[model samples]
Target: MDLSELRVEIDKVDKQIVELFEKRMDIASQVADYKISTGKKVFDKEREDQKLRAVKELASSEFNKTGVEELFSHLMSMSRKLQYQKLASAGAAGNLPFIQIDSIDKASSRVCYQGAEGSYSEAAMKKYFGEEVNSFHVDTFRDAMAVLEDGSADYAVLPIENSTAGIVSEIYDLLTEYEHYIIGEEIIPIRHCLLGVPGTKLSDIKRVYSHPQSLMQSARFLSEHSHFEQISMKNNAFAARKVAQDKDKSQAAIASALAAKVYGLEILEEGINQADSNSTRFIIVTNRKVFLKDAHKVSICMEIPHEAGSLYHMMSHFIYNNLNMTKIESRPIEDKDWEYRFFIDFEGNLADSAVKNALRGLREEAKMLKILGNY
Candidate 1:
């Protein structure tokens, strides 16, 4: 359409949109009444899934699916909010207590972080909650999850992704398996600084330790420092601790400058990321869902049928639905050779009606689908 005609058409659409939105709001109020009478909860997974499937089955083309899902996801999210407002007004889930990491006393609220004291995940937790938060150390990701489950810690900090390495499939898979919610995220620059005890010269160092990604970033430096043998550790921070504890000034670690300071080690070298902008994304997970004021991202994991154009056709659902995808990653499905599970992180809250509808359609079309979490 021409610019003038497009403007006029958009105006007309806007008018219709406002009208439909009002109508949706009215129906949402009615839904609140029905739910109250039936003693039903605000979120219904099965009902929500069934609703989306019905929409997809009725959709004829990708374009329609895109537009409708986008429109409906927002609509549904708003509708649910309105319904919640009504329920709250009637005194349901009233005066619930919410914890803010900042407000919580660092000395009181204990936390679990993966790896020993010098780990990147620990750095992330300290960044998010400050050093005052007494941290329980863990050896592995599952151990961190276990701490939260066993009530040993109120929350857990763990790395989700790295800029170079992309998505950490292990974290996403564990998200589904663990009883926790990703309440917040932190991005920490991955500076693989060379660390050792103070007064150690570069020539004195004999060994270096770091994670695979860290080792990869510092490959050039390692190659140049022929005297030092590179040792692979589970993580950068752990390497720092190992190097700090080692009595030999000849041994060092490749970790962030922060880790070196935390572990009482000295930086032998700095700026190790092949790209200076290296960063790792970490998440703050808790035992319960977070009542996020403005949900900035939505995370979903789904599966597509083993048919021609299945992936392409399903992705169109996101496109047609008008959701801006931030990330997409695929993992192999166990016992289902060649079959994969996909994780998609996108803009907009899942509470929106259009997103809900689009997802409903997607679930219907795909062999398997799951909303990993929405935060």
Candidate 2:
């Protein structure tokens, strides 16, 4: 066929594809109507998962695999929207938990975060609470908690873990030290970038600066260059500012890409984290106890007697109650010389009967036990 004829045919196919999508959406609307009549959810994750798996399996071209998965994921999101809209029109989806409306007021809320602006924790706070937050700065996690304890702040943000680093031990220790609850959680995407003073050249870098966590994340890129001395700062943003103010062109900072942009520092390198999937999980702590949403994580600490099967017995208690323990860590009791304290994060909430039963059993079998927070 001639090029003109072929182009016309391609345009015709594109038009047909658009029409087919509209028809599919119309069918989805009908399904939503039926679901509303029967009291059913607008979104079914299992069905969406199955459809995505089938579509991905049919993606024959290696180069198009990611494109196809992304395309379908977007389509599934749209499907949920169309379904919910239809159900909402019928007064069904409007009553569902997933269909949310209105933003909560944070105008008077004081948000406490480690470091100044451009820090990951600060970014996390804004992401969770937006500009409505009156953000306060803290030099350390302990200081942030102290702010909340003193009623200087309404909320304190702390990074609990990273996909690459596993866990932040200091943050976990602080969680046990303070009386607070994890009211909410956010996962920040971590992208370590090398930042230097505006006029600084790569050749002029004699020293690198960053928080220990940032340095650890960018170890690979920093380790290869032996000429640069790595200096650890208390926070990532503080390091960025130090580099920005430093007269030495050889001085650079390892921090978030956002931080480099904020400080007007040149990015020597980007995506310096150990893994592409690296993310830091932050929890919002509030001194005032709040009833957690049904889907929430509960953290508790308990001490088991120093006996042969005492630890084993605790494990059995969790098993008997059919509770999944997300995390379990033991630290030496600060002043007790050799005794140990256990910190655990479990799947169920304090309101769950099974969780309560397991805790009761643990308390009966052990010496000291505490339900840190329900959230």
Error of 2 at 211 (Å): 1.4
> What tens-digit string does per-residue lDDT give for candidate 2 at 85-184?
4544454422111211133356778889998777999889989988668887888888998999999998888898888878877876777788776777
Cα-based lDDT for every prediction: 0.75, 0.75
| CA shift of 59, model 1, Å | 22
Stretches of candidate 2 exceeding 4 Å from the true structure? 1-107
Global lDDT of model 2: 0.75
Instruction: Provide the lDDT at 237 for model 1.
Output: 82
Question: Candidate 1 deviates by what RMSD?
Answer: 7.9
